[model samples]
Target: MSAHRSLSWLFTLGLLATLPVAFAGGIRGTGDLGLVIERTTGSVRILETSGNRFLARVEGLGDLSHASVVYSRDQRYAYVFGRDGGLTRVDMLEARVDRRVVQAGNSIGGAISQDGSLVAVSNYEPGGVRVFDAATLEPVADLPATFGDGRRSKVVGLVDAPGNRFVFSLWEAGEIRVADLSDRANIVVTRYEGIGVNPYDALVTPDGRYYIAGLFGEPGLAVLDLWHPGEGVRRILSDYGPGDEPLPVYKMPHLEGWAVAGGRAFVPAVGAHELLVVDLESWDPVARIPLQGQPVFAIARPDGRHVWVNFALPDNDRVQVIDTESLAVVSELEPGPGVLHMEFEPRGEEVWLSVRDENRVLVYDTDSLAVLTELEAATPSGIFFTARAHRTGL
Candidate 1:
């Protein structure tokens, strides 16, 4: 098979949401664009591709420093999961906040369903998965963080499983959960033990065939078949790094900065100053992408050609762009300060970088690899982009 087709077919199988959504159909392609999910401003900014300039801003969010943007299957809605446990409903077309529900002390982050019918939130501190209505931005009734057992569970990763079903990770329990979002009124599911200690994130491949979870506490991995969610949830610990010393697991893995795409998972190994690229087929490490400093937040280009990574260390002032194919650091672009999260404008080549310490959003030219514009934010910590999510136009 050809290389690009090999990647595309792998995705035909995988993976949405809410609030009076009039948008239609799945995305054809993001076009020449990048989307920035701004946390501090509580706004998603639109940077036009004509240049790295703010074209328009999606408004009406509040103190969203720890939120994430996961688009609907059709790109009609953008689900904003906040660190403070605020779930905001946003209209992708109108570029406005439709509604929001706040969960106290909850840092909501996880995977959305492919059909955009359900959303799963991993409450790290409290240790549970909160199911929600994808469109109306409301909560769905389900088994409320309960197991017939006495042991309290700690959930870190909640994923969209097959046929609009849901699976969650119990970090403290070292187990995987299969729940029914399709029947949210009275959800029924089972839990199976896996290889790792604190499972941080889980994602289904584009083709909707396989699902994998990354372990944050131990050097372990879990792979499962989507159809038989209960079975095949096996944990593999073969490819663990050298000098693999056991760390304290008082709490679950602390958001080790992870994301998945193009049949690969990019997980930040802060202690090692490297990113683990896990292949889906064998469910193993195909390559280790190294960086100069401690990598924190990471993002992949829409084309799947490159991945942008940031280090939490003070010395790493710039974001390093890596060629995904070669697993090599291609270039480092400047936005300055301790850069953390990133968002791509919907209509441009620019990726918005959140320089928290600098309190600004730097728009860099993707082609020239130069800073084109910088929008000073009010205590800028996170950045996002929201625009008229055009179907035909984009």
Candidate 2:
């Protein structure tokens, strides 16, 4: 054989053999995640955040794919929710498809369960929430966030509570629904409505005795006693020398995400672009963590030294890291656009955020807020960390 032909053939053979074995560890087919690209109408990109470098790209899933995603408690798999309600499971380990299981009721942009067993999805267009099983991906249950008083109730957020109950936020009715998830068919629970017209989110305290409702409408906090369930839920920060005009169902001013630590709860107000620090013992707005943009999610590090907040819009390009003690914006890492949601690894060292508009996932060093690298997706929408989400032979 000629020398030039021999070298070319050898290189081609090596490339063929290396390609299959390189990503062989990542599982594919039924158990992997589906990177849904809504805008491109092409293949969806899969990101391997678990690895050092953001290795990527997958074909065939196409656009109009998954919307929201949920990771199993064991970190065994991830479920992607389509905009039109198509739900599929992605095996994280192998980084491939598992199979389709269920579809949602409407166009939901968010989904998460309290126990990580059942998925609660927010239906944007239809204005409701759908609940489903975490494993089987079947139509286990469905419900709305409406109140008996006849109002357009939209599901904003839903968190799993103890005693097989779910505390849901009603965007329009301005109430909180604690439904009995034990019986999916005929679930029943008491509804608590007070404080404001639209409670953006409801949070159960660690003691499980009382809960905090983010009064987005009026821009304050509401305290509900679990023992009473209703009994006229008390309005906290009612007279902190009020200044602004109070109204029914005012967003942006709404407080979302609950960080309960050091005998207090930290609520993020997206409208004011600040963290409404509330003391559980006193139930008052102690102080405000002035962030750069409208903050949506706030999660504390393991040492409690810092808490990271994701800005939703108007300033969706930054992830502000605040010092827990000073409660000041220590550093801001520019992670591109649409940095709405983020989650930490089990170690609390790695932060994974989805730049939905940019179609990329930015992984940052928790301490320095420095960009380690980024995982690019076709239209990378939702992301999650798998601490224990394992996978076998695909």
Candidate 3:
């Protein structure tokens, strides 16, 4: 071969050698990644989801008592919302914090815009929502939950809806508001007042058509037809509880824990040992399956066949599986003490759960209901996977 030809061949060989490095920066698939939040230590552990291997730990996050995470569309960055209002953008590939900001005094959770350009946080201290640039973590807009003689209310259940909108509920105001971010510089607010008494948490349907808020001070829930906003909000199941006598509430049921399966919704009844099955079509209560204890998180498996539920306080050590088709408890597993949270694999093959008291993360096969692997962690609370990037209203 001529010298020029030989040099060209050498360059081609070098390029092929570096191809693996390029792919390493991007997640190869959902099987290769996930995050475990250590609530007490204010840190996160990146893991290889398939093998249950610990990859890296990113720390120094502040007051993570009630933290949550959302990933960018590319699944390369994780936006973590902390209890102390700390929003830390973490680079999943490099296993480090790319950017960090303390936007408020206290924050509950957050959501990312449809186009992945904005990150919006729901706050409690100053009682407001703040939108920031997803790339830079810079302030984009500040929306305060002010009402009734200018008094602020704690904002909860903040979610990003289509058409550049961020929807949330005000706990004290008993209202729901939609902030249009089409013009991110100045948000146009649409308020739907008198939603219910003490709206604790809310969630948007998978199709982004309906937004429901669970009332803490009442037995029923408030629903809003997002596609038809002119109809306003209406109360559903207004008399769902045992009459007159107040029900005992161990912990406030989180709306985020509510699950949807096969055209129906399995919601944990507030302060009750039952899962209320609601028909998504008519918005009526269909059935209530009695559970072991007050449900904390009742999440549906990806295939919509089974729902795994964990309880609050004294019953947190156990997790039970419910069959969606028959509407009955199918299986039960003891996950040890402080079973804080659970997340299934993207396709529903396996699940990863955080057992805080045991200082371990347990991985179980969904079909067998058997523990496959366990990785040591410290006070782990939430388990998030990059696969959430492709889902709506995550």
Candidate 4:
């Protein structure tokens, strides 16, 4: 071969090597990934959030009626908590289950430890919280929700704190308990009793300083200072209820839907058609925004400028968008019946909502309230994005 030709051939090979290689199917980053829970089918459909693309489906998980998921720090694994107390660890990259165990008779949800080393499940059947090794799904510890009378109370609102601790609420006992898993083998449990009557659900602040439990037996919220345990539990919004004859609560409100946006918290008002906007710094009531029906999930967009809320049974077909700046409902959308869950894209540009009765997941533009696209799902309920991996209180 001629020397000039040889030189040109070598240069061509070098240029080809510098170009990106396309993997089989497609290459997806963590930011482009998400999961939609197929509740009745006991399966999860992986999605490409950027384009509303359905990637794959993983099945065989049991009783996912009220399911919740948390991701690993790297966003590679998903820990799915099922109502039947099934804890399944799914490999996001591989789109398969890595490990699973039926840890209890019934479980409400779960949380992954901050360090990504532990996964905790909040149970209702046997009534307690169980911690498992993140990688192996091996049992680490079990803390039963036992009251002073020795009766087991249902556990709820389990969240992971910064200091290797898991905080949760006891339903029957109406207490908040913080379990220090710093030393996993020797778990240290701290209980704060009499916070309220029938604490249903709880959530930790983004800063990991406050743990707030929503009361079911009363018209108030139980707040605890994780940073200052000695300060004790305080009840806020005690007078937010209408009167002695409160409206019937068809569905229990979820605090996980409570959103912290722009130094304020948007909480769902139980047994009412309103949202209680509270000043996070002062823990004071700021405003009450009336809604279409009983609010289920009042989730805020990542930008903190808007919050999207879904409703309970009779009003479950519609969703309301709340403008944080004005504290008012700016837009209302009826995606379909049985709107179960909504998850915003990491950048707040789009939102993915599961319409269970319609058997579809709809993606919408956050600003225009326009439907971007839709994907079919089976009994879909919760839409979880991989971006939650970096957030403190997932």
Largest TM-score belongs to which candidate? 4
Give the TM-score (vs. native) of candidate 3: 0.92
lDDT of 2 by residue, 1-394 (tens): 9999999988877754554323455333322232334335533445444464443443333234435455676555666656665556665544455666434445544444545667666654466666777777666666655556645576655545555566666677776666677666677866766557666666566455566777655656767776677585788765432236422222243232326657667777635656767787777667877677666667666456777777665777777787777778888787887775565655667767778788776778887677777766655554544432321100
Off by over 4 Å in 1: 1-63, 72-76, 92-96, 147-151, 227-230, 242-264, 344-348, 381-394
Model 1: per-residue Cα lDDT at residue 178: 74
lDDT of 4 by residue, 177-213 (tens): 9999998768899989888889888888889888888
Enumerate residue pairs that collide in model 3: none
Positional deviation of 147 in candidate 1, in angstroms?
5.3
Per-residue alpha-carbon lDDT of candidate 3 for residues 184-251, written as tens digits (9 for 90 to 100) = 66779999999889998888888887888888887888888889988999888787863466557778
For candidate 4, give the lDDT of residue 151.
90
Write candidate 1's Cα lDDT for 1-394 as tens digits.
8999977765553321331112223442333223455665666664434455554466666657666666665555667777877777765444467678775466657557655676667675565777777777677753344444855566655656556666667767777777766655667777676456667666555455555666776665677777666466776544664246542222222232225557776766625666778776667677777777666666666566677887765544778888777889999865677576665554337666767777777767666777777776554554544332221101
Question: Per-candidate TM vs. native?
Answer: 0.74, 0.74, 0.92, 0.93
Count clashes in each candidate, considering only residues at least 3 apart in sequence or on different chains.
34, 23, 0, 0
- Please report how far candidate 4 places residue 253 from its true position, in Å: 1.3
Tell me model 3's lDDT, rounded to 2 decimals. 0.87
Scored against the true structure, residue 21 in model 1 reaches a CA lDDT of 19
lDDT for 60 in candidate 1 is: 64
